[model samples]
Target: MNWPVFFTRLGSAIVFAIIMMFGLLYSHPMAIIGLALLIQFLCIREFMALVAKIFPEAYFPSWLTMLTQVAGVVVLLSVPLLAIIPGFFVVSFILPVLILLVTILQKKTALTAGFTALAALLYISIPMACLITLRGGAGSFHFAIPLALILMIWMNDTMAYIVGSFIGRTPFSPISPKKTWEGTAGGALLTIAGAAVWGYFSPLQQYHMSDWMVLAFCAAVAGTAGDLLESKLKRMAGIKDSGNIMPGHGGALDRFDSLLVTLPFAFCYAAFFMVHT
Candidate 1:
């Protein structure tokens, strides 16, 4: 292991963790929503860049990128404001309708812009909005759910790397060749175990050990899939990292890929749990 690279990654991760903690655990709901919006923009930017690289022949106008980002931000904000404000419901529909109209107006790059924006909306924007919804809105915001999700993903990733480095031999997938079956298994097991420990000791009495374990299972398995999905995109684009925003960690998308996919699955389960219980 290159010590310099490792230290760089560690340094960045510390900063990232601090930011995440502040964003998720902040007293106000807007903090996480703001952080989520920033993440949405960055992820969409990197994803669009990747798509551009993947399909060089396609014409990608800069305005569409801006529109997509704006749309995502508005949509995210609309979630918390929907109940509080009267017009927020209409605000959500306006942007999507505008997106369609804009795409229709572009005769040459219509499909390209439409689909790309659509994908970014679905891939980045919607997941983040789900995150906010999962966290609860302005009036009823609580951070534990999203915070635990992130912590479990971090734990799974860290343990997987350590375990894979020491004893991994079997390749986990072609998309991310560095990953190994041993590492993957170890990560999942440890994530579940860690969740169990948290559930056992956590003062948050709302959830039990089984709940934590299941959520951790979602994070580990879905996080792995998220990483591979990004890796596959990079491989197809013939690139190593998504962007250089975070030294040694690629980009925002690279960092939050797990959360994007994990949110939907975790949210579904959490929603079900809340409804059933």
Candidate 2:
């Protein structure tokens, strides 16, 4: 363990936590939405850069990437924007078509390249949309739920690294050579246990113990999958760290990759099954 490096990362992480709390826990919903949109922009940009690097032969153009970014933001915010702009939803609905149309006009393997842009747009946008949506609806959106989700993800990620570092023996996957089965299992167990405790004592009446446990499972298991997915992309792109936005964390994608996949599952569960408070 390199003590100096660990301290640097720890310092950076603390700073990150403070900023995130302010962004996510702001008094106004619009403030939170604004922060999320900013994140979406950074994440999508990184995703595009990775795709471009990985598929140099795909003929991906700059204009299309920008278009996808716009579409992604518009789509993610469409629900909230609906109340404000009224026309926002229509723009969100049509942007994808426009993106595809622009792609097809390139006339040579355009569809394949277009797929990359579309993939990036959907992959980043929907989860973020779910996050803001989590704080919405007439009592359906629970503030505590999103906070819990973020906490669990951070816990799972931190514990995974610690457990993997100390006793990880079996390689979990080839894509992320550093990860191990022992670490993954250990991290998940801790995260689930921690969530269960949190649920039992959580002041928020909306979500029950069961809900917290399920969400923890989502963060641990699904979040791990998300990390692996990003790792796979990085491997394909032949890079280390997606981008250097944070001192310790690689990029917006690196920090929130777990949240992206976890959001959909959490959203589905919250939207359909959980009894709203």
Candidate 3:
């Protein structure tokens, strides 16, 4: 455990927690949406960079790619207003078509063009939409669930690294050489313990124990899968990190990969179990 790296991560976590606290306490849906948009934009940019490296002939300019992505986000954010009107599907379908058309017009390979657009839609739009929709629920559970989701992800990540450093003898994947089964188990245990503790002491106590346990388990499994999936993508892309945006951390995607995967599940669980109850 390098002290420098540890301190860097610790400082980053502090700032992240402070920002999240402010956002949740203020109960500002737009603020949450905007922050999520920023993350999505960064992740899109990183994805485009990876895509460009693999297919340089695609001539996919970063600026243009970002513009297209932002447009998609705008469309997603305006879904509520657009829901009252007709032709929403037309707009949604048209945006991706336009993205593909632009890439093709640039003489990019069909594969690159297809992936670029799909990555933006899945990696950015869908996850951000899940978060925004969850926030709109605006129930007492809303803020707690998001916070709990974030904490569970952070706990899993931290414990995995710590335990892996000490007792990791077996690699989980060659793509992420640093990951280990021991670390994975440690992280899962810590994640469950943390979730249970929060369930008992935090405002999350308002929920049933079974419901909270299910949410925690979903977060743990999804979070691990998300981390591994990103690792797989980066390995295929032949990149070490997603982006160099975060010091000591890799990128927005690196930081929020778990959240990206876990949030949808959390949202679904909340809707099906908590909300329906």
Candidate 4:
């Protein structure tokens, strides 16, 4: 292992964690929204850059796609779900139509290009919307939900890496060969234990130990899938890292891939239980 690279990565992660804690834990509730939006923007940009590099022939309008993503986020954040649902339907189709029109006007015939923009909507925008919704859903002055969700994701990923490095023998998947079942299981167990411990000390006690364990389970599984999905995308793109945004961590997408998928599932679990019970 490259000690220098490892230290660089570790240092960067520590700085990021401090910033994230301050943003989510210390700042106002609206800071979560701002942070989420900022994350969404960076992730979308990185993803778009990856797609463009991988599929140069694919005629995707980056500016328009970014605009559409921002528009979707705004609608979801500002409007009620009832109104947003119908608006999303119209907004969804409009992008593809615009893509087609742009292709025609440019004299390029790439119908599949539109799908890239749509994929961005599903992959990045929707999950981010879910995160924002989850943050604001459980009533006012409750930023802890999002904070806990992030902490669980970070812990799961960190533990999996540590456990996998030390004792992981069985390869987990072809996409992420470094991952091991042993590591995955160990990480998950630790995450559940951590969640239970958190519940014991947490003043809010929004969830019981059982509930926290369940949520941790959901986060671990979904976070792994999310990590693999990005790996697959990167493999297809023939790239080692998504971008050089982070020295050892690769890019924004690389770091948050797990959280991207984990958030929606965690949000659903939180919404169903916390809102109703």
Please report the TM-score between candidate 2 and the true structure. 0.91
- Which one is best on TM-score? 2
Q: Output the better candidate (1/4) by TM-score.
A: 1
lDDT of each: 0.84, 0.84, 0.73, 0.73
For model 3, the stretches where C-alpha displacement exceeds 4 angstroms are: 1-14, 61-64, 78-90, 108-111, 138-141, 202-206
What's model 1's lDDT at 65?
Answer: 86
**Tens-digit lDDT track of model 1 for 40-155:** 98899999889888888777777888888888887777777877897986887788777867786777756676788878888888789878887775333246778889989999
Residues 162-201, candidate 3, lDDT per residue (tens digit)? 9999999999878678889999899888888877776677
Worst 10 residues of 4 by lDDT: 75-84
lDDT of 2 at 271: 84
List candidate 2 segments past 4 Å from native: 1-11, 83-90, 137-139, 275-277
* RMSD (Å) of each candidate, 1 decimal: 2.4, 2.2, 3.1, 3.4
Steric clashes per prediction: 0, 0, 0, 0
Report the C-alpha displacement of residue 95, candidate 3, in angstroms.
Answer: 1.8
Residue-by-residue lDDT tens digits, candidate 2, 1-277: 9898888889889987887787677878886688678888989889988988887877777687788888888888887777778888888768888788789788686776688878877788988888888866324676777788898988988898999999999999998888899989999999999998988998877668888999999999889999899989999999988898887668888988888989989988888867465
Report the lDDT tens digits of candidate 4 across residue range 130-239.
Answer: 66666664343256777777788889989999999999999999998899999999999999999999878878755577767777888889988999999998988899
